[model samples]
Target: MGIRVGTRDDAEAIAEVHIASWRVGYAHVLPESVLYADDFEPRRRAIWSEWRFAPTQRVAVSVDDTDRVVGFAAYGPERERARGTTGRGELYAFYFHPDVWGNGAAAGLIDHVGERLRAEGFDEAVLWVLDDNPRARAFYERHGWHPTGIAADFDVHCELSVPEVEYHSPLTVEGRP
Candidate 1:
């Protein structure tokens, strides 16, 4: 697989990966209605299209040998100023096609984002994950991320409210971990 910066043409594939990952990753954590929504694809496509052109966000995509986008990661300046941290970047989103879950695509995309964030002058990086997603939590932990004891309610399509926790990692000059 190859990792590269995302472009406008990757919007649709990124949206698809987002939806597919959520459907599988949050199957038991989110409400059935939210996960099974018939309009999910179109709505996600629209949102991703906007994200693709957003000036503040940096996005990257992981593609297979055939050049099909299999996963994506997005990051930028932290949006929640209430976190009380300055010079912090936030990983706005990260997802992979369910089929590639066990592969290294997610890790590679994450490393790319971390490097990009470090190059942007961010001192640290933070990301939120569903508190109940043990798999994701473990993944982050393995990458040297730790929860900051912060918790909040996350609305999934405004249809379900789930608990989320924030994970943080300091970015050094080398951007390792």
Candidate 2:
């Protein structure tokens, strides 16, 4: 498997991974109606297409040996203001096919994003995970991320409301160019 910078042509595949991963990962936490909606894939595809080309964001995709996209990560400048310190970069999204959940694809994708974020000059990064997702929280923690004790309610598809917490990690700081 290999990781690469995402392009416009990758939007559909990335969206597929997003929906498939969410269907399984958020099965118990999100509304079935939202996850199973007929238009979810297409809508997510459109959003990803635009987001992949955004100036301030970086999107990375992980592909299998056959070159099929199996996972993706999106990170960029922090969108939300931090309460106590200067806002850090954020991992806006990260997902992989359910089939690859335990096969190390997710960890590889996170490592790739971390490298990209640090190269972009960010010293720290943050990501939000559903509070109810112990598996996901543990995964992030194992990757050197820790909670900042922040929590908030996330409304999905304007239908399901779930609680989420933030996790943060410091990126390896290279001497600035």
Top-TM-score candidate index: 1
lDDT of 2 by residue, 1-177 (tens): 899988888988998998898899998887778888887777787888775669888889999999999998888988774354445778988888998989988887888788777877788988888999989888999888999899887877765688889888988653110
Instruction: Report clashes for each candidate as comma-separated counts.
Output: 0, 0
Q: Which stretches of candidate 1 lie over 4 Å from their true place?
A: 81-84
Off by over 4 Å in 2: 81-87, 173-177
At residue 164, candidate 1 shows an lDDT of 94
Instruction: Flag clash pairs in model 2.
Output: none
29 Cα displacement, candidate 2 (Å):
0.7
User: Per-residue CA lDDT of candidate 1, range 1-177, in tens?
Assistant: 999989998998999998899899999887778877887777889989885559998888999999999998888988764366666899989889989988877787777788889888887999999999999999888877899999888877855688899999987666744
- Per-residue lDDT of 133 in model 2: 96
Give residue 40's lDDT in candidate 1 (0 to 100).
74
State in Å the error of residue 78, model 2.
1.0
